[model samples]
Target: MLTTDSNKATEIRQAAAKHHGLPLLPRPTDDERDPLRWPRSLKLAALIATAFVNFTANFAGAGLSVASPVLQAQFHKTPNQVNSLLTFNFLLLGVGNLFWVPLGVKFGKRASLLISTLILFAVLVWTAKETAFAGLLAARCLSGFASAAGESIVPSIVTDIFFLHEHAAMMSWYTILVSSATAIGPLVASFIVQYSRGGWVDYVWVCAALAGANTVAIYFLYPESNFNRPKEPLHRVSVTGEDADKVQVVKTETISRHRVSVVSKSWFSIWTSVFTINREINILEVALRPLKMLLRPSVLLATFIYGTSLASQIILIFAFPSLLLAPPYLFSSSQVGLMQIAAIIGFSIGCFAGGYIADIITAVVIRRQTGNVYPEQRLVALIPGCLVAPAGCILIAFACSDKLHWVAIAFGFGMVSFGTIYAPNIAITYVVECYPRVVAECLVAINVFKNLVAFLFLYTAVDWVASSGWTQVYMIMFMLVSLSMLLAIPFYFFGPKWRGQVDISNVSEE
Candidate 1:
């Protein structure tokens, strides 16, 4: 038993080692089953699997962009109608979060992921075989629905397995895969369509193959990361003696066994466990919780910022074919695909700036604050991103309007990509840190907003650019991106107070 003495408890707490100058948050328990206590290798493997699924999801959604010309000619459709292939997919990707995340909450992240991966594999195969425009559209929409698991559940998994100190770094890794996949997918697809005899359909087949492999990998690599951990103190301290000199401190927390059992279960049993739904969870409430979360200002602001940034990327992707293929540039499909290299370069830098550098800055802030940790402390990382992303938009606008060098346009795309990674990484991470108890719902809300914004912008991208011209449209984008990134400043100062005012007890209650 632990003593209830306040002075001794305080002394023992002071004696404990600190993690980046702060105590471990949502403290891990003595229970070996707690995900936070899992082996480093296991934790990393799970994260890689989750991130790969995210990569595959985005790759499938955007890879077809490079093939737009081929697709338009094949389907005998207008540009806007053709763009619907990607736009509708984006819409369902957001809407699907509403469905899959609730199911993940009820069934298990691992289980939900497995089911979604299987569905994604089937849809990819269907997409490869579809000959008609409507068939391809339906197939792509289903793929988006299946892909939502990557967007919504991944952040929750990161929270489950990683400490607060590790969140930014881990999320950066996930975001790199996601953002890079979007950029790289087109690069790969452009080459495939340009060189392959099957043209655009070859890209769909490749995605299907990857999705099939991903399903098998998920089965083996991703176990149930969702552990219902009990709330406990950071550590329990007991003073064994009354004498100041003679007192002994006993640390009570111990791992009796490793979290993972070595005994192997039958494949069927594992499958059944993954599919089993938890009766205790309220399905309806889980589904509606994300919608309810939108009422919170922090949630809305974070989602809006993230949504607009993502939409900017979508619009750029939609416009690329039209601008590069038809303009004075008259670039080949392969050349257009290579343009993504610039975005990838930006993603690489942003990943380092947003993830590792942000983590370092956050630790410094915590130390300076005398070990006090706040969610807003992480916002400092967004400063560079806020400035860079909007500038990138302006550069792109000018490059297009003046018919500047292709390198200038590529550089602008790179800048916007940098901002996309930098700002949203902080925004989404901040929301999760603020509402640790309701991470899934918060992520669902962000994804819904992100996809909705992307869907609307992308659906109208062709006509919007055609009617307004690139300069006017991108200038408007510059304003929207700048305003959204700037909003973080106010939130950084007053977010804590505002967060306190919101009531999430009802939604988070078991």
Candidate 2:
């Protein structure tokens, strides 16, 4: 038995050193243990709780549209002015990541998650109660700021917890929640406002209810997932010796023993972890890291891909309600809400398929390229999605402009939703893998770029479509999206060369 255990540990150490250029395992502090080492059920519970919080945050952001008309009537605000609610909220959502992500880096993820969720809950309550338009807008700004945690911080959380092979599928869940929340928020909110006497207030209250539930769930379920392992390899080795040619061998029995011991901590001790900060964190360095990463070719490529993909979705969010309310279709708010269900279906398919497809395609590419997976292999997965997304945009433009059947319009919307979904899941997984040392910073850059691009679309989309006609407006979007995705071609081929140029000195694991 002792000899077998020695051989297993030797194989793991050799594999880790050969493949990862790092240690088999560090002398872990209480918080420095890998989250993957946790029991399967505990890790799964953590994922579900985190995803629910993500859903609640996005649900709040996307539901603002359903409340716009009632808000306009009550406050005598113009449609354009009401739209500013989304505009400013999105702006804050992007910019807020600069601060929130750094704080997550400086403090533990559980602390950051708890603090943000609590703030989101309070803002939702204020949004529910506020009668003044200005007050409501102010509340949403804070809400967006707080809710930035879901997009910017959660992906890093996934990276911290899951292994490289699991990232694509795990990230797909985050992408799905974000897209589904955007579509479903309006579907649920439109009906509530249309039927309930409480109107917009009722919708806000629903968001608040979900927010409260998410807060409690997170408090009970989410533990600190950040684990800073040593750069140097461990000195210990198995008696059997090194097998550098083989893949890493993880010993399940050994990990299970560690899980049993570590996870047995009391609930009170876990709760107090919200106040724990990463002692190695340098706040100033954390604030500046994303900006530096923005200059990297791989990072910039992800920005364009994710940013353009997000812009297409934002345009649809604003366009659907405006267009359906006017002209031949003359749909009610509830009907318009139902129209978004098409998008939900598309997003679900995209989210579910993107993960597996990316993983499979990447594996194939890896086998062909070097018999070892490279981060750039993930780019191949985006090719199909890139082509499909632009085509979907063109379809939407033609369908809406030609006054085609509602089914035609719905199909176009779904195609666009489905196509756009692929870009983020692939891009995020690729980039995170590429810069595991600075996952938070890379995500902050991506969010900032994506949100800024989406903000531009939000402000210009309605007017552009109205003035240029849907064909012209969508054609322009298609062109931009195509160009962005095309950029991936060069990266797919030459990404390693570009990545080699990056200055690792700027990267801090803390």
Least accurate 10 contiguous residues by lDDT in model 2: 232-241
lDDT by residue for model 1 (1-510), tens: 356566554554454323343345566666665677766776788889878888998899999988887788888888888888898888898899998988888888888888899999999988888888888899999999999898979988999988877788889888888888889899999999999999888888889888888788778876676777664322223334344333333332322111223233334543445664677789888888888788766787877777777777767877898899876999999998999999999999988888877876776665554445678888877875578888888999889888899999999999999877877887778888877778899899989987887777888888998899989988988899989877878888987787764445354421
lDDT by residue (1-510, candidate 2, tens digit) is: 999988877655555443232222223335526565665566767788887777887788888786677778899988888888888888888888888887877887777777888888889989888888889889989999988876778888787666555678888988888778888998998899899999878888898888888778878888877777444321222222144333333433353222223344346856666755777778888888889889888888888877787788768888787788888899898998898888888898898778876776664454344344567878888876667788889898889998899999888888888866788889889898777778888889988888898898887766777788899888888998888888888887788788874553455421
> Candidate 1: lDDT of 218?
76
lDDT of each: 0.79, 0.76
Model 1 residue runs over 4 Å out of place are 1-19, 231-273, 501-510
For residue 44, give model 1's deviation from the true position in Å: 0.6
Show pairs that collide, candidate 2: 10-238
233 Cα displacement, candidate 1 (Å):
8.9
Window of ten residues with lowest summed lDDT in model 1: 254-263
Candidate closest to the true structure, highest lDDT = 1
lDDT of 2 at 269: 58
